[model samples]
Target: MDDLAVAIGLVLVIEGLLWALAPRMGRRLLEAASETPESSLRLAGTLAVAAGVLIVWIARG
Candidate 1:
C-alpha cells in the first residue's frame, strides 16, 4: 500500500541520517536494543503504544 511505502521510505531516510551523523552512537543504540531484557522491551513497547494513542487523540481533537 501507499501508506506502507511512505512509512518505509521515511524510516530509511531517518535511519540513513542517523547512520551518517553518529555511526558509533547508532551502533550502540542498535546493540543496546538487541541486548535489552524482554520485560523492559515490553514496557518500552507499551509506553510507545500509549504515547502513540495520546498523540492520535490530541491530533484528532
Candidate 2:
C-alpha cells in the first residue's frame, strides 16, 4: 500500500541521515550491536515494534 511505501521511505531517510551525519557513531553502534547478547537484542527489537505500533495507532486514530 502507499502508506507502507512512505513508511519504508521515512525509515530509510532517517537511517541515511544518521549514517551521513555520524558515520563514526553509526559504526560504533553497529559494533556494540554486534557484541550485544541475542536475547537483549530481541527484547529491544520487540519493544521498538510495540512502540512503533503504538505510535501508528495513535496517529491513525
Candidate 2, pairs of clashing residues: none
Superposed Cα deviation of residue 58, candidate 2 (Å): 0.4
Give the Cα lDDT of each candidate.
Answer: 0.89, 0.99
Q: lDDT winner among the candidates?
A: 2
Q: Can you tell me which runs of candidate 2 are displaced by over 4 Å?
A: none
Candidate 1 per-residue C-alpha lDDT over 1-61 given as tens digits, one digit per residue, 9 for 90 to 100: 9856976898799889999999999999989999999999999999988997797689767
Candidate maximizing TM-score: 2
Candidate 2 positional error at 10, Å: 0.2
Judge candidate 1 at residue 29 and give its lDDT.
Answer: 97
